[model samples]
Target: MSPALASALAAELTRRADEDRELMRQAETIPPPDHRRRIAQCHRDNAEALATIVRRHGWPTAALVGAPASTAALMILLHAPDPGFRRDGRDLIAQAVAEGHCPAIHLAYITDHCAVDEGQPQLYGTRIDPKTLRPYPIRQPRDVDERRREVGLGPLQEQLEALGIRV
Candidate 1:
């Protein structure tokens, strides 16, 4: 990757993070409907911009775009409203992970997100239900921790405890 391209991607990632943080900080103050709309709009816009980057540069692996920018790219895809787009991004991320270009944790999160979106049990219990403060569902609850461990994630219970869920 060209130095200029990397720098530009990093800058864009920083801007996206700043905007996301600001929106989240104001979420409680904004009415629920408006807050949801603003969040959705931001996700859509970021996903669209990331789509262009993906088309031009593929998955933007850490080696190509640096770790922070690559992780930010994954975050944008993870928050996308469109399930099809998210699944496509998941595939790209999975391939990148297989080739050691991206973090395994990225694949873990996106895999669970896509599965939940499709109404299927997630292979990794990485997605927690905010309402219940528990994992949404796992393919095999008994083996979920093993699956998560393979992907560099801690046990689901531990993760919940870390979140103050008292699991």
Candidate 2:
């Protein structure tokens, strides 16, 4: 990928992150009904934007624009209301990882999320409740720590602590 394209994508990713973060902050405040609406709209628009970019450029692998930009794209799509869009992004990211272009961690994260989204066992136990700050129950609880370790994720205790959830 050209430097210009990489820069452009990185910039756009940064902008999306800022907007999303601001929306989240607003959502945390009292009387955030308007912010809730704004967040939904923002998510829809961001999803469409990523879809368009991916359709044109395939998955933006780390080799294309650095890992930051690629991961940013992955994160935005993960929260998308449409499961199909998230799965599409996951497939592209997985292919890139297999081709040695992107990091395997991205696939690991997506795999867990997609698994939970599909009501199956999540390998990595990454998904958490927004309101309760607790991770969704993993399918095969006994094997979770092993799976997470394989994916470069830290201990579940550390992960939950980092998310501000005790236990």
Candidate 3:
């Protein structure tokens, strides 16, 4: 990515984080039942928007870090098995990567809140290892990027190379 594009992406990420945090803060101040539903809806919306963007870019894989509901929706849309249906997370991620789609992982602040307030990481940074079919926590964007480079991208590149998909 060009420097300008990279800068713009960083700015957008920061803005998103801020917006999510603010929304969570507001949700917390509200009463029960409604608060939970509102938060869930917000997350769902965010996830759908992210998925739409990913699809528009013609990428195959996306990792949802923080938003569990959103990630679940994505999995459904992608025809991946539901997390409760004995499906493997890693395999799904790897498959998407192999298909040349850019999988996205979401890291939502609500996770941190859940961790501190509820004694657990809500739904942030959760990743499924396509190879192992296990859940792994992706602590940061760099972590996901690195893993994609090491496991997903590298193998896919090798396969493409074998098929003569090269620069």
Q: Per-prediction TM-score, please?
A: 0.94, 0.90, 0.33
Per residue, candidate 2 scores C-alpha lDDT tens digits across 15-133 of 88678878888776736678778888889988888888888888878888777888788778776889888888889888898899988779888887888789877777788868777
- Each prediction's RMSD over C-alphas, in Å, is 1.3, 1.7, 15.0
Task: Tally clashes: model 2.
Answer: 0
Q: Pairs clashing in candidate 1?
A: none
Q: How many backbone clashes does candidate 1 have?
A: 0
Which regions of candidate 1 fall more than 4 Å away from where they truly are? none
Segments of candidate 3 deviating more than 4 angstroms:
1-14, 58-167
* TM-score, cand. 1: 0.94
Instruction: Evaluate candidate 1 by giving its C-alpha RMSD to the native, one decimal.
Output: 1.3
Against the reference, the lDDT scores of all candidates come to 0.87, 0.81, 0.40
TM-score, candidate number 3: 0.33
The true-versus-predicted C-alpha distance at residue 59 of model 2, in Å, is 0.8
Per-residue lDDT of 1-167 in model 3, one digit per residue for the tens?
Answer: 34564344334434444555566688657898887776566555544544453444322232222234334334333221222211233344445555644333311222222232333422333333355543333345345435445432333334335655452
Tens digits of per-residue lDDT for model 1 on 1-167? 78998889877965785687688899889999999999889998988888888898888788788888888888888887888999999999989999999999999999999999988999988888888878887898999889889999998888888888886
Q: Candidate 2 vs candidate 3: which has greater lDDT?
A: 2
When sorted by lDDT, best at the front, the candidate numbers are 1, 2, 3
At residue 75, candidate 2 shows an lDDT of 77
State in Å the error of residue 130, model 3: 26
